[model samples]
Target: MKHSNGAQLFLRNDPAKTAPLSTKKPLTIGKASTNLLCMPQTDGVADHHAVVRWSVGHGWLICDWGSQEGTFLEGQRIRNCRPISDGDEIQLGKVGPVLVFRLAPASSQPTPEPAVKSSAGGNLEFAGQLIPMNQIKFVQLLSRPRYPASFSWWALLSLGALVVLPWPPAFWTLELVVLAGWIVLGSRKEHVLLVTLLDGMAYRHSFANKVTALGHRNGIRKAIGQPSSA
Candidate 1:
């Protein structure tokens, strides 16, 4: 079966209960009648449990709406808004319901480029090079952490020391502040866009802003006649 544009969610236990995500608005899940994915009879679900929406800079994200039982993304109870990737599982509550996220499928056939000259349309600007959209064979996004796990682990160990060391109140406060900084810094990632040409050559462009990288990748996909996973 084929899915509509944008992303989609299917029930974990029942894939047939698939719902496509909206690009124009948020998809609300709850027992309330106004919710797009309303489950009036579902247990453990609140009136406004959670919402899935698209952010221009962050792509697709799922945020808990202060539900009685918080939402879980792959078993981890999400604190705030968390970016959703393809194949991620979202649980409504501790035991309410489960939904799977999926990206739109690519076209089965290669898109035929128009007869106009490549220069007819403006080329995609990338790292100071002009690339014809038709020359792109594939596009992929890569994300890598800016810091190693050990940095965060050391911060955790320092925080753990306070429990047995009987540190002063000021010292405790300083440790807490440092740990917070470590967490925020550790979570930073570098996003890169990889574009492969039909001739087998490939090029990558890195972006400090995830939204800009996603936009570039999606634009290339659309220009090449493939479905945008945005």
Candidate 2:
């Protein structure tokens, strides 16, 4: 759905655009489609690997990874990511059994509860409220929050080594060229650290409440630790 402010959307699907989520969890994908994009994992279980990036900050989060048979969604085992929709059952690998996911659009409002004459199941012992799907626990595998302990500190050390030292003395242009390539790939972490460093600097220079300011910047309540704006 189009908004003047350009709320978060599934870059892939333009049909039913969404708004900021009720909660900042990854499952609360704003304006994104259920077409899951499973990125390639060299690891045996491609769809289940960490750093899966098909979610555009909003959408069904399938943690289908690592089992002899593999996880199945809606009776279909995903060889690669597939579009998910309401009533889709997600089978987590081994730990828990079958859990279904039901997606409800944001714009639809709850109708008023219908007046009841007599409870149909009044004599039957009631269990609890039926939560249709198991809660999806979201790990922002691709985008780690920029803070100390957010990423493997190994990332920082590698960048430091690359920046201060040149290639070995006996190394030829081939080695130098390879080193440059290494630096290029390793630079993603460096760029993130740079943002963290910038935040650090800002924290040092001012008296503004760090948590509140950062939370606002992240477009979430300060305590929730959500990563970005919608």
Candidate 3:
């Protein structure tokens, strides 16, 4: 969707109170002053809650940063970064303040071409594989949390070294660093684009980045003349 003033988030109850979103950086939604969509007085809002940002192939996406109460998109708790559309309702918590996503008026909407390419005749080329468009049943985005096996081995080795190392205070800093790295790695995830065929066989392509994955999904939908479903 094309909007003259980008996108805006208005309070569900009080539409007058609105927060304009920026395409440059991820908009932070929280009770802190640093957040672009600050809800200081709102109940259940955390300091560093959720974030909304424009992605490359995914358009707009909202993600919860391990918030206490959690963030909900259209009544579903947002586990991973979820793509959002116009008129979508986002609640900070189960009973927290609600914000409605809006795309401001514009003269013309963007018409993006499908990423699909003609490999052989009318067959579609996706993820380096060629398949007929007629065989496509549906396309969906899937996510799974994954921590690198190497990281676990390195973490265990580090902890073991810390146990036997001298100079307790000096090595304590390194231990803390390792712990932080482990936490970050544990939260890492892998995104996949699963294209199911009419024959019940599915083709899965993994993407390290969600934006690229969403782009492929959007392209497939356009190629098949199907509506976008996030």
Candidate 4:
């Protein structure tokens, strides 16, 4: 470690091994690193895949990937997530080891805290309706997903596959089933859109008429000031 004026810098063979130093001046590391690894959002995650995946931020990435050996942090072997630290050795699953971490320049200022996002789950509320947690799954199954883009491609691919298939058992049932699924997926998108538009119009008209009627009733009731029903 060396100091110039009021700033200090640390040089290390491995940036991941450097520890955070407290300081009064803002410290800027040439490169910062952390052991916590986050993988890409995709690549599959199911109840049964064995290996789990998690995402951090920046360039940090971690994956059990399919390794049975697993990753570790502190002293605990993490089966659900990769290890992360201000500075530490990364024992990357079974594929040997890779040292990774954020390298912060030596500092005189108090070590700044990393930004963290809220991981808390929130509730969904509908006007005049309070849905209990247990009923959420039932409602979700009844609802449709947004922006499903596979239907059109499925339709195209199914058609192409049908053309290439020979006659009999293979093409006979499978082709029709594929076509049905493809069609169902398409119609679902259209159905959802139509329902949304119809509901929007109905809601608009219903609210407008309701407000107008309520206004008239209020006017009459105010004139009387005795008792009125709307």
- Full-model lDDT for every candidate: 0.77, 0.34, 0.78, 0.34
**lDDT of residue 134 for candidate 4:** 26
Runs off by more than 4 Å, candidate 4: 1-10, 13-28, 31-83, 86-147, 176-230
Please, what are the lDDT tens digits per residue for candidate 2 over residues 17-67?
333222123331111233132223222333333112123323434543344
TM-scores for candidates 1 onward, in order:
0.47, 0.26, 0.48, 0.25
- RMSD to true structure for each model, in Å: 13.3, 17.9, 14.6, 18.4
- Candidate 4 lDDT score relative to the true structure: 0.34
Instruction: Give the per-residue lDDT digits (tens) of candidate 3, residues 1-230.
Output: 12225578888898877777765667898989988777798898899899987654466788898998999999999886899999999999888998888875554323332347433225664553557887888999988877767477667868786777777886787777777877787778899999988899888989999998888888777777787774
Candidate 3 at residue 135, lDDT?
A: 82
The TM-score leader among the candidates is 3
- The residue-level lDDT of candidate 1 at 140 comes to 91
Per-residue alpha-carbon lDDT of model 1 for 112-138, expressed as tens digits? 333222342545656434577778788
Ranking by lDDT: 3, 1, 4, 2
Off by over 4 Å in 1: 1-6, 106-230
Residues forming the 10-long window of minimal summed lDDT in candidate 4: 189-198
Q: After superposition, how far is residue 211 of candidate 4 from its true place, in Å?
A: 35
- Pairs that collide in candidate 1 are none
- Residue 164 of model 2: what lDDT? 60
- Lowest summed lDDT across 10 adjacent residues in model 2 is found at 124-133
